[model samples]
Target: MVIGILKMDICLPHLHSLKDKRKVLKSLMAKLRQKFNISVAETGGQNKWQRSSISVVLTCNDSGFAHQVLEGVVREVENTIEGFLVKYEIEII
Candidate 1:
């Protein structure tokens, strides 16, 4: 099996408090999980209101497929997220 992992750093310029951050993160996480059928979580920058890091993980029988899925996920995030995606990294194992 091939495991694909994607880590994304995001900047929420409109958020003014942690509550707003949680709301945005929760909605984003739920949408990502439901749409991609992948595991998603807040992996870093939890205490900051304007910045956050999320990790997406998926497993597939083929490495090429795994890479494609990760790429698709990245595209989806870039298009749908309410904030700016600062950077991202993908790994396959």
Candidate 2:
């Protein structure tokens, strides 16, 4: 099995409250889980509204699939989040 992990740092420009931040994060997480069949969550920067970090993990029989899925998830994050800027790192094991 191949495990692909992606760590992403996302910046939300207008986030003010934890509730609002969580709502947005949850929506994005749900979408990623449902669409990519992967596990994703907020791994860091939970308190701050303008900055957040998410880690996404995908396990599959093929490495190529993992890579493809990671790419798709990154694209989706970019498309789904408004005024979102992201820095990401990906690893396969």
Candidate 3:
């Protein structure tokens, strides 16, 4: 099996407080889950209001397919978010 993992550092510029951040993250996460089959979560950056670290993970039987899925998912996430993105990294194991 091939495992794909994606880590994204995101910035929510419109958020003024932790509550706003939670709203944005929860909404985005719901949309992501509706569109993809992977598991998603806020894995880091808990204390920062504007910054969030998200992780997505999934497993597939083929490496090429897994890579493609990860790429597509990452792209979708980047395009869907209203805020700026700091960085993103993907790994296949």
* Best candidate (score: lDDT): 1
- Evaluated at residue 27, the lDDT of candidate 3 is 87
TM-score of each: 0.95, 0.95, 0.93
Estimate, for each residue in 1-93, the C-alpha lDDT of model 1 and write its tens digit. Answer: 889999999999899999999998999889889988999999999999999999999998999998998899889888877788999999999
Residue pairs whose backbone atoms clash in candidate 3: none
- TM-score, ranked from best to worst: 1, 2, 3
> Which regions of candidate 1 deviate over 4 angstroms?
none
lDDT of 2 by residue, 33-93 (tens): 9998899989999989778999999889999888988999999999999757568998999
lDDT of 3 by residue, 1-93 (tens): 889998999998887999989988998888877788888999998889999999988899988887888788778878888887799898999
The TM-score of predicted model 1 comes to: 0.95
Best-to-worst order by lDDT is: 1, 2, 3
Off by over 4 Å in 3: none
Q: Candidate 1, after superposition: displacement of residue 45 in Å?
A: 0.5
> Which regions of candidate 2 fall more than 4 Å away from where they truly are?
none
lDDT of 3: 0.88
Count of backbone clashes, every candidate in sequence: 0, 0, 0
